[model samples]
Target: MSTPALTLQGLGKSFGDVRALHDVDVTVESGTVHCVLGENGAGKSTLCNLVFGGYRPDAGRMLLGGNEFHPDSPAAAMAAGVAMVHQHFSLVTTMTVAENLLLTQHGLRMRRRDLTDRLDEIAQRYRLRVDLDQRVATMPVGARQKVEIVKALLREPSLILLDEPTGVLDPAEIDALIDTCRAVAADGTAVVLVTHKLGEVARVADAATVLRRGTVAGGGRMSKTSIAELLTAMVGRTAADLDPTVAATLGLDTAGPRAAARQRHSTALDATAPVLSVEGLCAERADGSTALAQARLAVRPGEIVGIAGVEGNGQSELVAILAGSASATGGTVTLDGTDITAARPATRTELGLGVVPEDRHRDGMVAGMTIAENLFLGQLGRFRRFGLLDRRAIGRAAQAELDRFDVRASGPWVRMGSLSGGNQQKVVLARELSATNLRCLVAAQPTRGLDIGAVDFVLTQLRRAATEGCGVLVVSSEVPELLALCDRVFVAYRGALTGPVETADLTAAQQISELMMGVAA
Candidate 1:
């Protein structure tokens, strides 16, 4: 057989006391895609960084085409025919795509016209179409991802690493990206895909490896291994308890006959009366661009309603209007017959509105404060005693809330910024759900950056809150998440709401995908 494109032999890496990778080994043959599967904190990122020269391995060795390879920096890795596209993009927003591509080519000077021509030729040859003159800031999330892929390919690397590439893409864009990867792999380039989405694995991966707690759990050729075996290796559990319907969609067979019985039962909602009502909502951004236009929706008590769309298309504006952070230009918002259209954020909070914003670090909690302080931020009056503040009471309340949420931290006194992303989200959920007289809960992208376990916990909490008669609205770009949890889903396209389609009636993801593209299903 020809030499493997890349090989890792007993690679190990550590950060202080944490063993990020331990005795891990993987090999990728030429002209094939190798998928790395793991949950959050499962060492997937560390392994990718080790290969891309972001971190030096503490032990073992790496070989590139049977030659011992040690790269001291990303530049060295690039020079050695290896490239990585980070989860968080590294492109300059103000620069044009052509300039961004040229920025990486050191010691090479070419006229702007010549560079554009060369990039156009490469893009045409690879079928990766991109506007060379468009500014990165003006491009949508999907377009920016395509640009990143083009940049990686411009280097003519023998190996490329894509980290969680499909997290922000729509269905059509995801399919296009997968096609691009396949086309590149056909040219004898080794591709390493690090992802959590099982469906993508079944679609494109030639070989799969599962990493659990810094060790190689299991792996094999995709054609030879069963999905049940793969899931068992990644999650460290039998598939017996998983829902068969969801499992089958994810390309895995259910382990037991009772899998159908474990599916979440849909909650019934009253059709006539809505706890929260929004009609003809119109809003604009700071740049005077339309953010929302004529958006209308309703959520009944004890119901979980989902808003599905791509990254943009008025989701953010609607969430802001409901949370009282943004003013609506024209429309009416009512909360249980009370007009909250002109209400302040504090007033909305007083009226039993609990909002978990999309950016947890920016809008959910104050990172500089201690966990205790963040827990009781808006309800400090409850802990106040006599003419002075009650420190002991506040501490006790915060500790209780943290414990109730199962937030794993050093203590309540720990800084909120010091906790993990999942823990910070737990703090947000605990604060909002534990509030007194909570009539409505608005969760926007609640599980965006969380692990599998954290996502399961958050979804359960939302369901439990709905069961207790709180109106729940979940706005997310993830269709599978909405299908799994929401009682009914509303598609948002260009600020218009369409189809409060019952989850029971929705049989396939293509229906939702069509609606997301503003097309009738």
Candidate 2:
């Protein structure tokens, strides 16, 4: 029998009492895209962390080409012909693409021409185009992702791991990326794709392994298994008929009264006045470059309005302006008849504006602070007594929010960084939603790294918030998310709004996909 390119035998990892992975066995052959499918907490990330040298396994043996492999660090893994493209780009944004590419062990002071030539050669070979001289900061999300992939491929690795690579990409970008991954696999490099997107698995992965509750549930060649079969394996149940997988998890019948309830809610949201409105909004960078110009939008009360666009096309700027973190160069922003164009972030908070920022690691919570401290970050005024923060009161409040939001963590005292990506997002949601007077809620990429269950919970929460008279504006790069949650959807292109169309009107995923790509209806 031929040895697999990569193999994991009885792999197990634990964080104190939390068993992230338990006795997981999987194998990947060369020249194939082997996908790992699991819900958010199913140890898929833990397994990847161990394999990519981000974490040491508690017990297990990893084999590469019939040889024992134990990578002590990411560098060590790279040396052993293993490369990982993180879900988030790891490039230094201030640096040029060529510099970022050469920053690894491949760093060498080559002539500028030589660097560009090398980049061009690699990109052409992999069919992953990128501007070598362009600053990483100026690149689009798709292009930045290409840079990460190019950097990994430049190392000539035997195994490449991509974690949620398409999570932040639009539908068209996703299709392009899928093609790129398929091409990469054709070049004899074993690709390990970690994702929750079943459609992607069906499209690009040659084989898929399903993990559930820290153990391998089932796996087979992608061609042999139907999408429904894979879904069953991943969730431990048959969910073929459900629009989304939350039907069983939420304890609701898909073809029953619950479906009717959701449909009624989705319908009721179609005919309401916007809780938040923006017209002729424009935002500029410090360098005087326009990030958003003439952007107009509306979020109806008791409904979610999703703004879908490729990243760096003014989504960040829009969020910053709305959240009052940055001043809008030109525009009117109103929340229920109150003009807040010049309001500070604190003032916006006081005016019932709840903002869950896109960059969770940077803007959502302070990494150094405890979960409790992070939860109470902008809400200090609410817990203050005679100009002093009530520490005991804040702790109690934090604990309550943690429980209510279903944030899985050790305690309120644990560092925010110690929790998983999903839990961190939950912390952000808890902070923003707890503000009782919130009328306009802005959630940007609310569930970027969360599992299927968490996605459902977050979406459900947003809908519940909307049902209570607070308008919700969701800006996401993922089309399925927008299609699943929002009542009215808008396509953002070069900082321009294109829609206020009802979800029922854009029922087909292809319609939303076309609009996001700047296609006219």
Per TM-score, the best of the predicted structures is 2
Instruction: List model 2 lDDT by residue over 1-521, tens digit each.
Output: 77799999999998888888989899999999999999877887778778889999888899988899998998888888899999777999999987787776354455567667777777676677777789988777778988888888777789999988977776667788888888888988899999987777878888999999899988889768776777777776666444352443222333442344357445675565667889999888877787887999887777778888777678888998998888887889998888999988888888889999988898888999999998887667788899898888988888899999999877798899888788888888888888878888999988776667677678778878987888899988766556556666787777777776556553445666776677862
Report lDDT per candidate: 0.82, 0.80
RMSD per model, one decimal: 3.3, 3.5
Best by lDDT: 1
Q: Give the per-residue lDDT digits (tens) of candidate 1, residues 169-195.
A: 766778888888788899889999988
Candidate 1: 10-residue stretch with minimal lDDT: 254-263
* Model 2 CA lDDT for position 339: 93
Off by over 4 Å in 1: 243-272, 285-290, 365-374, 380-402, 413-421, 506-514
Q: Which whole-number lDDT from 0 to 100 does residue 260 have in model 1?
A: 26
Worst 10 residues of 2 by lDDT: 249-258
Candidate 1: pairs in clash: none
